[model samples]
Target: MAETMYDKIWNAHAIVERDDGQTLLYVPRHIVQEGSRFAFEFLQDRGLTVRRPRQMLASPQMSISTRRRDIEEITNPDQRLTVELLIENTRKFGVTHYGLDDPRQGIVHVVAPELGFVQPGTVLIIGDSHTCTAGAMGTLAIGVGATDVLHVLATQSIWQRKMRSLRITVDGILPEGVTAKDVILTIVGRIGANGGKGHVFEYAGSAIRAMSVEERLTVCNMSIEAGARSGMIAPDDTTFDYLAGRQFAPRGASWDRALRYWRSLPSDEAARFDREIHIDAATLAPMVTWGTSPEDVVPVDGRIPDPRAEPDAERRAHMEKTLGYMGLAPGTPVTDIAVDQVFIGSCTNARIEDLRAASAMIRGRRAVVPAFVVPGSTQVKHMAEAEGLDVIFRKAGFGWGEASCSMCVGMNGDTVGAGKRCVATISRSAAGRQGRGSRTHLVSPAAAAAAALTGRITDIRKMGA
Candidate 1:
């Protein structure tokens, strides 16, 4: 029988179909973080223990501050406890942990792929919505809640209903200024926020295949915001090349066996999806989200959407609310929106490649407003510094931060002040995301750098070669 890439993975990992119509999906990995401490708390309360400790990779990054001068500083009581609890839980459960000072420590999703834990045909879950970031490695990665975390930790499996599959192919070549970030933002805008509900997206085509693994991770990282269970790309030589020498990658004979399987995980010619969307990459523009949602995106050179022109009443109201919160009026050019800050980090866009891209654009120019460049992982940070990317950013007046979420969700000490607007490469842009009354403009690293250069929402295409 013909099967989509999603089907091939799902069937391989599925244990059995339950009476409730949900399948018992075997968990290949449980990527835990500080937020999942509650699952441990629940386990302690119930006297339950982890059935597969080795399968759980725990990280304590959600509450850690990447901007702190003193790495040991943890003044916030709640944030302090979150870290303490994660440490206690990981120790208590005997799960593999990468602590604060560990050179391997980083955001869970970032560290997973960085260490080669996420390979093609893998089934993994994390306690954060952005777990899909690992899906870039061709894994069927999903985010779960505390309850689901407990289940996975105790049994190494969770229940899942069958999901429809959506195939999105962006063919042709991507222009120089346009990027995977822009392509994804353009997709969400065209499909709407709920377009991929109950579906898994298989990202294919010339542009997708041509992107480096880090860029593909950026594309999959925000699939959640578009209402998809996960987004994945077929593994190819590029994917294998990136995973070859990483820490947790299969070794010796095991690697040979793994590689052979990974090569077969791409969709077959006979595979078919429930729906398919095609995009012409040649005409794509650098994208920027004007309002709160990821779907509220437009080309960097485009104008603010007019709510009155929207055909759907509910959509019009949503647009009006988002535009009002963003202090944008209809027909206002995105270029006119001056920003107080530019943040160039997050799991979505903090890889070494992303840093290099932004640094190249920021090298000779000084930022008008404060800007930050937080690496996604320790490995990425070291690589960026080794290449003198940090020097480039600092010379351009951008603060170089350690590997942590940083201003992405305003979780730790780093935050955009109230009433300020920021152009960020983070996955989200909702109200109070960075800080109270702080508006976020979600853009690519290039767009973020352009904003830093001009202190406004400037188009990267207009920034010149």
Candidate 2:
């Protein structure tokens, strides 16, 4: 019997089938953050201790600042306390901790894969919704609530119902300026925010296979925005190559054993999925979200939709409300919109490749508005500096920030001001995702750079990107 990649991974992780049709899954690794404070407290109240401290990785991502080089620079007292609490709790339980001062410290999702803690054929979960980002390495990554956090803390495993599978196949070749970010926004737009609900999305086909591991991470990272349970790409040479020399990845003889296991995890040709969606990659253009949700997006050159013209009453109302909040008129050209700020960092688009892409556009140009260009992690920051990418960005007048989630999550004081419109490379554009009353137009890094240079929603293709 041919097994799907999802089935192979899921079955291998399943320890026992519950009579109620659920399975007890053995969680190989658990990524915890400041958000897990309550979970830790919950365990503490019951006199419980972490079952596998080494298998659990903890970090204070939510309270960490991209603006600060050291812990004392985090001025917000409450934030400082939250970070301290997380560190204290992790210490109390003996969990492997990555504090703000830790060189590998970063958003849980970004740090995990970069440091090689995440790998193919592993079942991992974090409290943050973007845990799906790790799925790029062919791991079954899921996001759970604090209660599930406590469950994993005590047992190092989780009980779960089976998830259906949906495969999205991207055909043809991507045009010169099109990016993984655009491709994902296009998918969410077509599928609607809830279209992929109740399923795991397997991103496949020629276009996806051609993407680098980092690009695949960007794609899977946003699967949550499409309302999917999770998203993943199969492990191939690209996956092994990316993980080859990472600090936490298997070394020597262990590496050989790990590689052999990963090689057999891809879905067989005869594997079946519950649903399939096909996209023509060549047809995709630079995309930007027009409304509060990711699905409310269009090509950069496209116009805002008229809600009254929509036949579905509920959807029409939603469009109208979102448009009202966005201060956009029906049929308004997206290019006509001007941005007040531009953000170029997030777990989704803050990788080295994305920074280089932005640098190509920002090299000699000055930013027309405030632009916050943050790296995804310290390692990324150092790598970009070693390549002199920081000089190009700083000379262009962009704020070169330290590594963390930065403006994407709107915490840590890196926020788009109230009522301000921003062009961003973050995964989500939901109202308040960037900050209260902030209107976010999600785009690729190149597109974001073009917007910052022009102070408007300009297409990267037109700017020669």
In model 2, the clashing pairs are none
Give me the displacement of residue 412 in model 1, in angstroms: 0.4
Candidate 1: regions farther than 4 A off: 68-71
For model 2, state the Cα shift of residue 401 in Å.
1.2
**What is the per-residue lDDT of model 2 for residues 9-123, given as tens digits with 9 covering 90 to 100?**
9999999998998999999989998888889889999999999998988776666777676778778888777788888998988988878777787778888889999999999
Please give the lDDT score at residue 391 for candidate 2.
94
Candidate 1's clash total is: 0
TM-score on alpha carbons, each prediction: 0.98, 0.98
- How accurate locally, in lDDT, is each candidate? 0.88, 0.90
RMSD of model 1, in Å?
A: 1.2
